[model samples]
Target: MSLRFSDTVHGVDLPNNAMLPPFDDAWVTSWGAERRDGIYVSRPMTLQVFHTRLLEHAKCNNVTERFGVTRDTGAPAVSDGILWGVASWGIRKLCGTERFPAMFSYLASKSNLDFLTNGTQILMSDKRHYPYPDNLFNNRAETTPPSTTS
Candidate 1:
């Protein structure tokens, strides 16, 4: 699905090209930096929860392909999407549990910050394409964790 937004706020027509920025190479690089520097330290449990939530988000949105996951694997197949790289790195770190809430808050805040700061790009001309409404934001329904049977 294409990423595009167009809505009037207070009678002013919002630009149609205001779409969520694609998670590109620069984002990947920054993720690597965060991992190396331990800037956003996270515990193993928190990272697992984050990974699960991210995967569930992708699955619910039907955008698993974008993140490089497939039905057979049921795992992040590649580090193409923004969250994929972070999640993969977190799994590897397996850091001891501490400041779990802080880590989760950091991730959530960063995601929103990226969307607002990095995603918005204004051009002089008004030549932009806006995709039809896809109801992406509305599909964020709570996901039930996988059940285990012993």
Candidate 2:
């Protein structure tokens, strides 16, 4: 089965001459459920492709977007919790087409985040801080529109 996901990309810095690592050791996590009508929905599991090597490969493949933040605006009082870049994902399925998108949508609905907006993005060299590799840090490039604050 071939599952491919593609979307317009923005805000990414591509790396030169890079190759991704294996997925066997990748990490996966869920954001939990959303309360609706006194019920909870299952949150979709987002696969984290941490391996720095893999991230490098993703950048080469054009699955991630690079963006520059407008620093002119005074820094936040908290000094944190601001988004700098995003990672977009494309899921290509080799079998069962109808069920895939629907199932994924259902799972994402439980997380309370808009699946379409909170997609994935490639990671820059500076974003690697976690001792353990995480999927959130790994991202591929896409041909989406670039994000610029002007």
Q: Best candidate per lDDT, number? A: 1
Indicate the TM-score of model 2. Answer: 0.19
Which lDDT tens digits does candidate 2 get at residues 14-84? 21112112222222122333334434454436521221112232344442322111111211111012122
Tens digit of per-residue lDDT, candidate 1, span 13-84: 122222322222311111222233544443233212112233322333342221211111222222223222
Q: What's each prediction's clash count?
A: 0, 35
Clashing pairs in model 1, backbone N/Cα/C closer than 3 A:
none
Q: Global lDDT of each model?
A: 0.26, 0.24
Q: RMSD to the native, candidate 1?
A: 17.1
TM for every model, in the order presented, reads: 0.22, 0.19
Candidate 2 error regions (>4 Å): 1-17, 34-150
